[model samples]
Target: MPPARSDDDTDGTRAALGTAPIEPPVAAWPAVGTPADGLTEETGQAKKPRTAAFGFIFVTVALDMLSVGVFVPVLPRLVAEFMGGDAVASAAMYGLFGTAFALMQFFFSPLQGALSDRFGRRPVILVSNVGVGLDYVLMALAPNLWWLFVGRVISGVASATAATAFAYIADVTEPDQRAARFGMLGAGFGIGFVLGPALGGIAGGIDPRLPFWIAAGLSLLNALYGYFVLPESLSREKRAPFSLKRANPLGALVLLRSQPQLMSFAVVQFLSQLAHLVLPTVGVLYLTFRYGWDTTTIGFTMAAFGCAAVIVQGGLIGPGVKKFGERAAVLGGFACGIVGLSMQAAAFQGWMFWLAIPATSLWGFANAANNSLMSRRLGPSEQGRLQGANACLQGIAGLIGPLLFSQVYALALAAPGTFPGPGAPFLVAASLLVAALVLSVRATRRPG
Candidate 1:
């Protein structure tokens, strides 16, 4: 019992039942010009919802950092367990562990960057998450120092996600928006540290190995989430062929040389990174040996530090930059770092140590500002390369910081009369921050 075949009825039927229009193939989509910040441009088909992408990236980074924070509070105690209560030997071995991680990062970071450039960001990031999960599992099962070292090596090789993640941000965000966005990214780190160390401390109190298993579980879950939701940011047409020449870590540094200003900024970056490394390398040990702090106390202190970071990086950085400009923010950040380091070095009372957290959190502003400034100077195609170079510098700092600070700490503990104090390493770090501040000031004075 169909309706009568009027023209209107026929038209309505066609509208309701006719085949839906087909979307253009991804290859056939028109390419759009992105902002002239030399970062990645989006094509029609490649453009997805950016807010979702940013959220995913933020969460992923937070989780990655969280796992790190969870283990840090227990790392020194775990080492002590293996070394028969010899603080000096434990400190020395901790340095070796850090060195192993850094060595792997130095060699592999550029390769990951280059791979992201060719294949895609999603696959590399997913793989990294999986690797980190497995590494944590290995560490959880480790019965001795050698096995622990193996875990660190694996983790380091898998930790190139940061650089690639930065490149992903560069691909999606406009130049003017990058600073604020980067600040938010820093916030993700802060939040991770906030939850990770605090929980790790509590969990470590129950059983030091429990946090590792928990961290592994979280990482594996992250990988699974990413496999389903993460989208490709780089388009095939914009991707460059991977080359061993560009993939070499030493060769990656050469790219910075091509931009003289970037080279100066790189040095500034290096000094800051080097100064910051003293904390994770020696913070737990120093607190344990000097202040006689337990795992829970160290974790809470780290959480406090993380809270400060969240406040500054998440809430204050954008306004600070808007009010003072990027250069001034960099200078101010370094100044805060010097003050904080000095406080930590001289802190005789436990409360004095807690007071330094907010001041040191301001140091993160320099990182976001400096990175945003340098990122703007390059084109889209170069974002991965630039991030890779920065990763190399961080790797170098990681390699040197633990060795220097751990040795200094051990030496101070071993011969309290001969050396200044266990805080000698903090003083050294403060000096490095001073150098970084001077360089940052000098770089700002130059004509662009």
Candidate 2:
């Protein structure tokens, strides 16, 4: 070939590398300063296209809540069926269920989030929905207590749609608007609680397993809707290649190291979820053990909590944001949580318990405001990253809260009754909220 010309040699080299024109690596897409990198989303200036994706995510997640909440009423009862009717054992089972879910999330949420960053949000979402649906079916058919454990384990791994959903919003939003979008998801959480539990309670009366079947069906339906309708939000150019460390929950620690503001917000997020973890797992156990209430009475009490959350998230959140600004709303919300915690801890009678309703309403409000604040702080590119980290933090709380509450409950039973009451956790959780309030005030303070 006559000592191949320089042009010919260059062409051969380029061909071997499969870049005849020297195309840039896909890493360049989300690289700092790239338009598609999600930086603009942090600005809270997402265009119409991003808004549409946000709406899609909201719908799918709402469906997830519908299934999960519907099953809550029956979870303990079903466990009792296997424990030879020992309530304590059943309660332990419930705590174990939460432990399984939270522990898995501790590892999985970040992985899913990072993967969505690379593979695009659509597939991860679709897979999660399917996994959630399957989880419901498994629980419904569980032949023994172990099966229930298996179902929870599987579901926990699969129910990570929230991570992908958050990423989708990030892909389309600006940093400033992230909080508002996240608040909308919180609304979905509230709505799911309102409808899911009420319906689950009713269905559970007929057959303890009925709610699980219904939830499974809904998850499958959600999967179908998602596969057909959810568009790809993270484009090929914007994804990061998957890394073990980045995909793990520890990624939050790694990513937050460089961003102190984000780290502070993440701490607040963890504490908030920690407070919640005490309630859902231990609250009902307290009512039943202390007051000897049945499913119907328990359902009514929880309904009160759920209804308040619904109204706060779905109805009042927008106005609150408009009136108070995100920071003020957050502070006010936390203040409400403090009040509610006090009410629940002080409740020695049913009427006093009712007072806790308004307090939880405040908790809902504060959570919404915090979410909105965090959203605003992120650039679009960082949305999935932060949300994933947030999920992991919640998972961490989930893991810690149940074990702590269960241990406390056990200790109270064991000692000459020293752990105060089921309300003790609420007291601790409340104090934590007060600390959170102080932190929020400091974080949002304007720099001189």
Top candidate by lDDT: 1
**lDDT, candidate 2, at 385:** 68
* Tens digit per residue, CA lDDT, model 1, 20-105: 11122333222346422323344523333366667878887787678667877787788888899999999899877767777888
lDDT per residue as tens, model 2, 1-448: 5774586675575456432321123432234543333444346343544444566678777876776677677888888889999988888778788778768777777878877877878888888888888888888899999998899888878877787786676566543344455667777877787788788888999999998888888778777876766778765755677788777777655776545555666788778888887678687787876677897788788777777776677677666554445666677788888888878876878778787787678676667656545544544445566678888888778767877767766666566446465577778888889888888777766545
Provide the lowest-lDDT 10-residue window in model 1: 19-28
**Model 2 accuracy (lDDT, Cα):** 0.71
Give the Cα error of residue 189 in candidate 2, in Å. Answer: 1.4
lDDT values for all models: 0.79, 0.71
Sum up the clashes in candidate 2.
27
Candidate 2: segments with Cα more than 4 A from true spot: 1-46, 49-55, 76-94, 142-148, 174-176, 288-294, 376-378, 406-423
> Roughly what TM-score does model 2 have, to 2 decimal places?
0.80
Please state the error at residue 340 of candidate 1 in Å.
2.2
lDDT of 1: 0.79
Q: List the residue pairs that clash in candidate 1.
A: 38-379, 38-380, 39-380, 40-380
